[model samples]
Target: MLNFSATVNQTDLRLAIIECGRIAYERHLMTSNDGNISVRMENGQVLITPSGVSKGRLQANDMLVVDLDGRVVSSRPDRKPSSETPMHLEVYKAREDVRAVVHAHPIFATTLTVAGLEFPVDMLPEVLLTLGDVPITEYATPSSHEDAEVIRPFLKTHNAMLLRQHGSLTYGKNLDEALIHLERIEHVSEIFWRAKMLGEVKLVPPEAQAKLLAIRDAYFKR
Candidate 1:
């Protein structure tokens, strides 16, 4: 699998952000001007999606470089960092291991958030192995400090979460993993929704859950 970690230059990082946006759009995870993505660079700077643009339509030059304090560090005519810049910055500040952050509003994940369904646990080996628990942040005004604060507690334990009534957030050691986790949440939500329609969702037993988690730990190490 091609991953952004193959990158070693500034150009590669910029293009990776564009790829993240395109992948989100292709998967129907974003539309219009609805999503945000960011990368914390090796130099300790940040590259983020500009405000008020479609993620699908983003070009390499559309990215903005900012400092830890959200000050623009690069030149741009009209583009500023994403309004959700605070949210991305907070994740990076809180999770030292997270290098990339992605926020998108995929159908099933957002539907589950809007309908108040918590992310499932032990219902499927894949869900448990991929994400132990997808936390749901309390609803707060979007693009505000209040929204950022709601997710503060989950950063250490989760790689993905549903942002109450707004969208979903996923972060990782690299852009590919971050984007994959976002997609994984949506896929898991869809699977559970369909299974519920068939009957009550079948959950994996505790013993089986432990074994699957062990396997997941080994797999993640690779």
Candidate 2:
């Protein structure tokens, strides 16, 4: 039921996936083999990071292709699809517009969930305008079908989410946008955490927030 994008050179997409992983690792969005990245192909298959490989050092050939059903379509003989494939597949199944997904254990974002601290997203205009509200999914065992189920309700309304006591999930029309969403989550979390330590943090005025949401809605419409 998903409408795939136009044809894109698979090799280039593989390289893009590699770059996303490296940047994420370098930025500390994820550490070691802590995260997964996937990009949907025009043919409806997905290019994803291989299991057990350090994302920072991923090679183009290390990527695997899998159908929406989470079966491997193409991959090196020695490679396996990410263990989190079910989570990625659910994303594509539930949202056709999502072309890429980035799941990472960002320190601040994950810490927010671990500490059970609420993120006042409306306090930041950039967050309100770009990401709206990022909801936290109930705790689900990692890499399981439950992971998919827990995030299902949030898919329709949010492009970014916090996994209870785990990490974050973000997706967009492309990998860059998805990565940016992950970054925004960590950035906003760190800011809110720091502000809470400094003292009580004031929210954006309600009237201004309404205006920002209007702009956000108009932008998303295009």
Query: How do the predictions measure up, each by TM-score?
Result: 0.94, 0.95
For every candidate, C-alpha RMSD to the true structure in Å: 1.8, 3.0
For model 1, the run of ten residues with the poorest summed lDDT: 1-10
Tens digit of lDDT per residue, candidate 1, span 49-119?
Answer: 99999999898888999888889999479888899998999898888787899999899888988888888
Candidate 2: minimum summed lDDT over ten consecutive residues — where?
Answer: 1-10
Model 2 gets an lDDT of 0.88
Q: Judge candidate 1 at residue 77 and give its lDDT.
A: 94
Q: Please write out the lDDT profile of model 2 over residues 1-222, one tens digit for every residue.
A: 112244667877888888899899999999989999999988889999999998999998999999999889889999989889999999999989889999999999999999987656888999889988889989999978889999999897789999999999999888888998899889989898898899998899999999999998888541
Q: List the residue pairs that clash in candidate 2.
A: none
lDDT of each: 0.86, 0.88
